[model samples]
Target: MYNLAKYQKLKNKINRIERAELGFFPTQIYKLENLSARYGVNIYLKRDDLSGFSTFGGNKIRKLEFLFGEILEQGAQNIFTYGATQSNHALQTAIACRRYNLNPILYLVDVIGEGIKDPKANILLDKVLGAEIKIIEFKENEDEFEAMYRAKAESKNYAQEISESEDDYYLIPPGGASPLGTLGFVNAYLEMKAQEFKEDLNFKNVFHATGTGGTLGGLTAANKFINDDIQVHGINVSHKDDSYLKEVAELSTAALNLLGIDFKLSDRDIIVDNNYVGAGYEIPSTRANRAVKIFAEDEGIFLDPVYTGKAAAGMIDYLEKGKIEKGSDLLFWHTGGTNALFAEKKILGNLLDNHI
Candidate 1:
């Protein structure tokens, strides 16, 4: 149940923190009528995809609002971030940098080795935004995380050469997963609660794709803060180790602390289903592509193969497997990445196949 007093208190705490005006607030939450009928559940969508600043809006914009606020306040000129070549976070960071007249420097890991030669999708958009793009190629037998760590190290060296002092630049973690960035989604949760009050609907389950865990952390923190019973289920978009859940829990606690909320999140509070990662990050899956097609054909809504498609697949699988109760209220957070549909063929992986 939502407590108005607690909600107001939390909002006041968040009001004291600095944040840039970025995307449209309280992104429309409406029922997925066709899907709800098909699944025998009340299906709703939190349309973060329509979160504007661009047509390619996604969940990263939420984090960037808080991150850019801090960057502007600190008078940082260069903004450095990390992600895959087609990372929505990297693209959104570049967009935010452009908005604030800050220099956007990206150390993008070559997750899709084939897409590096010619720009497409987010990479093309990054170029158009005039971001200083640095592609970090993978070494033989090197994993994505290893390459990302190397990219961060390289970024540090580059920053030192270009800037007079550390204060002259800001380094945002991959996917903007820091405590400050997590505050954005905490604000998002509060916004959703306000909508719930207006709509007279109570969502019991929330499904969203989880990459670096900042969004999940913030949602979990906000849920705990308001004493809501909503189960925030993070559908893993990539292969994460056991420690990932612990890290998200820690992040949630940190965000709560920032809001002066005396609550802490535990592993028990974070629910992540890891069954639908398919092959790996950015590699399109058969089921995910099928899910994308279904959303497009059935609801006239588009979902990307990388994140939202896979998350929708997980939600469908849960419905089929009876993991989610029949007639239960489910809210799918559409953390947009539809631009990845235009990326290289390697990442698309038979997404256009008729069989899907």
Candidate 2:
């Protein structure tokens, strides 16, 4: 479905860009036996979950490679960023900082207002990583957009202020969704394609959870470059409107532009299905919880409630609804947030219920 020659060409093209070796590359791609039998489709998994630097390896580690390379190139000693209290990106950033002995300052917004003082999951990891964390809890009846904007504005203001005074600080955008960060996934796309080629697998669909848009942007851009028959699917794990779609499309172009690839990405290239985001952000749904359990039970693989599990739910629904034909080749990109399985109960959403 993709060219092996273009894979080498992409490598030669992106090798010019500086990047830190933060995690082991070429994450495993393998088929799921039980799930494939159940779904009546060839369901394979790209185990980016096993991406190692720490045991908490995730898709964020890929973004960090390029991001930290840029940071080290600039000789940055301190870094600042924003995310939710339990963000996988924030925790991964902290881990990367520890490796470089760079100080990490995380200004986190409390989307769920679950009293994060007793940290769990990624928040606990941040503390272990010695990240200076400032949690922002929203006021009663406050608008979510207002709260998010205010938190980000304040975080950047503080970062800029500190940078002006004592030392320069590198500020990464939330979820590391910057154009440079998106390049990590562009590289990831090439890597996965190479694996598929080596295994002689032809995938018709590639599905993953989409948040912050960087990963999706990179994938869309690379898919355009390869012109493969594969359908890149982004199952929205959170709220996203047409504006978000357009923004991601622009980011796709920007990432391709960064790679010196002259390609224009349209709205058609970015296929986002927002149907799986039940309730709201960080709020788990029944389908997602079931999906998480199903993966764990059937394939002995873990999927978190927030991201990959929701995406799994979408793929499951598609299979059930005949959106994916029987015997079709499908690939699920496990972006890795299994830590959230041990997170707060509110987010877990009875994932442990109906147990033996």
Candidate 3:
């Protein structure tokens, strides 16, 4: 437990930051009774999945609260962002942009095929929202991040070609994984802390999927701010190395700075495991597929094949290896992306059970 005075100070500081009202605040946390029994640990889920501004609720809503707040604050006329074709961040940005009457333009890097034109899950929703999109194809050996960088570079060229004024547009990184966006997760950490106190909750560890590292940043910042020692495990849904770990730490530190909190994050504060990224991002793996099935059967909760599925699989892996002590309290932060279930069949590779 942390000092109440310090806790209040941290909470107050976070509240001072500007954020657009986006999702429902303090989304519920509940014990996974049957899953606890099956896995031999006290399991709980922090449901960022049901973070509803719309029924299409997701973890991105939290980040968008701060992101859109900053974007709209600047009075930008056009919102430009980057992500994969079925990018949840891009879709949510479209929604937020429409809500404020600002036009949305997307520069999407294709993780699968040409995602922007594919008209699937998020891409389809992007179309419905009338977002202008540019699909960034992988040229030869260029990876996703490389493609993302190139996409950002091309965004300017595209903007100039379209004759959109530079001041009229704002470019957000993929996954809303910016320092400002990271503040959302920092807010989430505060929410969870409040929940922990109210219920006498004791989570020795917290697990979540990490993509562009925004959520990871927030979770780490929260723990640091409160001086809590929770072992927050970031299970990679895509390939990430030690450099990514350092970047996440840096991002968290930057986020704390935004809140007027003085804190420097180090490698010790960031924990990430890159082993669970099935085949790759947007490519569902057999292990992740089974994970989706088990969570559905046991908790009746749907985890998307792309992000949360891989995270659940990694948590289960640690459980199997006895890396986590028996009977210890563990919390899985459900950073939602269930939209992928309705995405292309490739993303839903293992969601189809033989019985069903």
Candidate 4:
């Protein structure tokens, strides 16, 4: 029931302007019948994990579709991005840049433990992509780190010293949580709606990891435009309790504007749970471990520690707590971080040993 007129018009425009080649075809949406029966709700899994982008399929590629388009259109031949040493966004951006014939300069900070010697996860894939990496000891907030990178980038000798200025472009933060990036998920909402309608089922709850806040915000705004009553729940993957509400509010408004839909949003539509985030970003939690093991054992599914595991844990906890009424259709979005499992396999050794 979206503003069909506006939705179609925007879709036409995106089709005309965006230069995205199909990296992934429709990721499957299948009913988790066993889980549904157990939870007393119609639960469905949106398998964004099947994206087929590269070594590790993920939801970031969807956002990168728009980002790379802008890079190409801007006549940029070199790209710059920042992230953790093992960041999926950094790894995937490297891949996208190579595919589009762009050189990538990755400024990875914090040459720390576990991620240094063992690049088995996304870090290994990043090296495979041939992205020129610069490792620095970043020891401050994002604003501070960004300021340092900007100062470094703006140095007269940076591009000249690196020989990358000829056609340079910049990529934003991890999760690619900008307005353009969020458009990818906004479109995803529409796609999901199409599938839902085709299957003749209306999902009441939509769940995903709220890392950078863009995906959840975009999906929520898209739901409003589509005029659907679906609730989008974001399980926090980082400490954004105070700021996430504002971020979602602002981004959702931007989404509404892009779709040309007239609507106002409140905080009630956005649900975020920080309880299961564990120690911090990229660190695994006991709850997440249980969820990952359960899903793998029961459903033959693989979820990573950083994203999918936490989100799934959040959904399961809600079910157990009776926060979600029984028999309500719930959708769990698998944002694809299965590769993170390989990085944390050491943590799973006891379980692995038992199984062996």
The candidate scoring highest on lDDT is 1
Query: Model 2, stretches more than 4 Å misplaced?
Result: 1-7, 140-145, 164-167
Put down candidate 4 lDDT per residue, 1-356, tens digits, no spaces.
45777566555644554745535857789998778887888889998887756757678878788777777777876677766676677777888887778887776654233545656677777787877876655445554246436535653245565555655656555567777778778778877877888988778889898887778877887777656778888898766556678778777777666555556667766777888887776766777877888788778899877778889889999898888878777899998878777765543333343332
lDDT of 1 by residue, 154-189 (tens): 999999899999999999999999999999999999
Residues 1-356, candidate 2: write the lDDT tens digits. Answer: 56657667777888889998889889988899999999899999998888967898989889889999999988877788778889889988999999999989988888888757788989998998889998888887775566767777887788777675434678888888999999999999988887887998888999999999988999888888777778999999988788888889999898878888787888867899999999878999889999999998999999999999899999999999989978978999999999998888889887878751
lDDT of each: 0.91, 0.87, 0.86, 0.73
Worst 10 residues of 3 by lDDT: 158-167
Off by over 4 Å in 3: 114-118, 160-166, 353-356
Model 3 agreement with the true structure over 1-356: per-residue lDDT tens digits? 65667678878887877778878889999999999998799999999888968767788899999988887788777788998888888888888888789889999887888454457788898888899988878999899989999999988776666645666678788889999999899888889988988998888999999999999999888887777878889999888778897899999999988878788998777899988997799998888888889899998999988999999999988888888888988999998889889888878875786642
Which of the predicted structures, 3 or 4, would earn the higher lDDT when compared with the native? 3
Ordered by TM-score, highest first, the candidates read 1, 2, 3, 4
What is the lDDT for 247 in model 1?
A: 95
Candidate 4 segments exceeding 4 Å error: 1-13, 138-167, 255-269, 344-356
Ranking by lDDT: 1, 2, 3, 4
Using lDDT as the yardstick, the better of models 2 and 4 is 2
Q: Which candidate model has the greater lDDT, 1 or 3?
A: 1
Clashes of 2: 0
- Cα distance off (Å), candidate 1, residue 91: 0.5
Model 4: ten consecutive residues of lowest lDDT: 347-356
